[model samples]
Target: MAAMPPMDDELKALQWRAWHRGTREADLMIGGFFDAHREQWGSQERDWFSGLLQEQDVDIMAWAIGAAEPPARFQGPMMQAMQRLDYLKAPK
Candidate 1:
């Protein structure tokens, strides 16, 4: 049997969804972003990220890749932070 991942409930839930987003690209973008930043996020940032999780993976990818503009409500520091894509690793 496989060992379970260690995490608190909130973080476990977020990480699960982040890595399981419909596409590998979405997973890398969202999951990598979460891994890079989760340690430093505050309550409001967590809430905002939770809201972002409700969006479709395609839309999220589009926004992150600049293929489409994020909706007005999603346009702000957090979205801008996502747009940076600094968390994505370079291919080896």
Candidate 2:
């Protein structure tokens, strides 16, 4: 049998804080992306999402987060937006 990885207080605290930090970072990035772009997508987007608001939001954001590539139809625009965002985020 393989040896199990040892657990410790330091490791647990590190992971707990890291998990929250990561959650905060993801919320900031993805939530900001939604606040920044959801309005700009137009009625076409609204209509498309009209029935599936829950999934649509997550799907679009997952694309922006690099969690998964957007489908072909979404690739061009989201990629363009992501590029612009990347530029805006670059150090002066």
Q: Judged by TM-score, which candidate is best?
A: 1
Per-residue alpha-carbon lDDT of model 2 for 1-92, expressed as tens digits? 56545545543433343233235544444444444555355556444333222344456457666788666655565555653555223236
Checking candidate 2 for backbone clashes, the offending pairs are none
**TM-scores, each model vs. reference:** 0.86, 0.37
Pairing residues by index, what is the TM-score of model 2? 0.37
Candidates in order have lDDT scores of 0.87, 0.47
- Model 2: CA > 4 A from native: 1-22, 47-62, 65-68, 86-92
Please count the clashing residue pairs in each candidate, in the order shown.
0, 0
The parts of candidate 1 lying over 4 Å away from their true place are: 1-7
Q: How many backbone clashes does candidate 2 have?
A: 0
Candidate 1 residues 1-92, lDDT tens each?
56444567898898898899878888999999898888777788888888899999999989988999999888998888899999899899
